[model samples]
Target: MIEFDHVSKHYPGGNEALTNLSLEIRHGELLVLAGHSGAGKSTLLKLIAALEAPTAGRVLVNGLDVGRMRRSQVPYLRRSLGLVMQEHRLLMDRTVFDNVMLPLTISSQPPSDAAKRVRVALERVGLAEFENAMPITLSGGEQQRVAIARAIVNRPSILIADEPTAHLDPAYAREIAALFRSFHAAGVTLILATHDDTLYSPYGARRVELAHGKLLS
Candidate 1:
């Protein structure tokens, strides 16, 4: 459902983050992006999400060219995507319910319906009882679960997670990995960028590695 055609991304001062990186991610497929820091994995994800424009080439999501889409059109395009960053990005001052409700609120979903969806998402992440709790009071693993819940609350078709298990312990990392596996099995197109090979390698998903901004053969 996504394609990168000769895509290259360059930041300020002429630093190239990705170089001619091309790949296709099919619907309902679970893909793993494995690489060290500065290997272009995060840049690739941002390109797909339209958060960063490609300096050259094109990025297409569900047949629509993201690189060519209008700024106003981005929100509509992103409605189908669920993004989880390395940082939890939770609102520490807000309750879990409110944080998970943000996406739906942005979309102007009805309150009654949004609440039900948020409850389901929290349950999926095994945080059903913490809906009224504050983020600061939760454990690291619990906070990550809250982030996951917030991402998927809208029931997006594609899920992209960047370094999701980076700060968690081995057990919590495995828990998060297993949760992602369940989502994959349920037919969500998943692309996870992680430096931890052991966390996802056992899933036998198609693996793509990058080195110095280029895909490794």
Candidate 2:
């Protein structure tokens, strides 16, 4: 379970990203965050991954206080979480297979096992044949698929994305949304921050809107 207890995040120059917000994300649930560009949606998502710490209150994920965890422990905390963003963040120089295998390279898993897992993840995303291709060679939607494949290579329990399908056409956006639905159907916890609620509303996702750093609904 993920819990945010009256969390508030303050940045320098009097910028407040989030304010006294409290939320709970139960395991195996798909939740959508809908809001305008600066509604703190991204800030809330970052708190889960420990990319940013709260100025007040605590972020607890599976019983660990993320805001208070030592820097050395952040990576361990991230192992259970998969993150995708608007920017694919792929290494243009690396092949798709290598990019997906990047996460496992840091772990103790053997090379053959890691390679197998990477191929499996790519297959799940329907991109097994493109493993040897480069990110730049694929279309926008395919590049996003590669990013998704890389994210699930470790089989994270929670998958969070920030505006993942924002740049795609309607058809491709639906495809990506369906891909996310497949992951959720497999029992992965999904927390998505997106402007287009229609992408997941038909699937019965619970959505909470944020306005000016506070929950509006």
Candidate 3:
């Protein structure tokens, strides 16, 4: 449900981040964006997530032009998508339950409903019993799972992960990859950006390679 047509992104100082990159990510498909650092992988993800507007051309989600959408509609677009980052961007002071509750709470869902959703999300990420646990007490793998739980807690239609397995050991990295697969199986449109060949090579997903801001395709 994501489309990029002749899209290009140029920073204020004129560094090109994407160059006429055209791609289509189908609904329920697991697409992997693979490349080295500074290869525009993250830039592409940010554009799809609606976190950054392209300098030229278009980015569409479900046929809605992301760059042309009203600023007020951003929250609505974002709420429909789940984003997992390389770093675990959890609130240091909050419990895992509260962190997962943030999305539902921000969307103004009732407390009772948010609690139920949080429980399900944690369970999906294999973190059900860690609800009351502090984020600081968790291992890197656990923290990453918590991040994933927080992302999908809202049941988003699209899930984007940027280097989701960066910090973990090989075992945990595989664990996180499997979790992504599980989400894909459940029909969440998935896009993951990574430099790890082992993770993407074996998956047989549609692969897009980027180098110096251009799709090598």
> What are the per-residue Cα lDDT tens digits for candidate 2 across 1-217?
9999999998898888899999999999999999998899999999999999999999999999999999999998887788899998999999999999988896667999999999999999999999999999999999999999988999999999999999999888999999999999999999999989898988979899998899888
TM-score of each: 0.98, 0.98, 0.97
TM-score of 1: 0.98
Q: Model 2, residue 160: displacement in angstroms?
A: 0.8
What lDDT does candidate 3 reach at residue 53? Answer: 96
Model 2: residues with Cα > 4 Å off, grouped in runs:
none
lDDT value, residue 87 of candidate 3:
96
lDDT of candidates 1 onward, in order:
0.92, 0.93, 0.92
Off by over 4 Å in 3: none
Model 1 clashing-pair count: 0
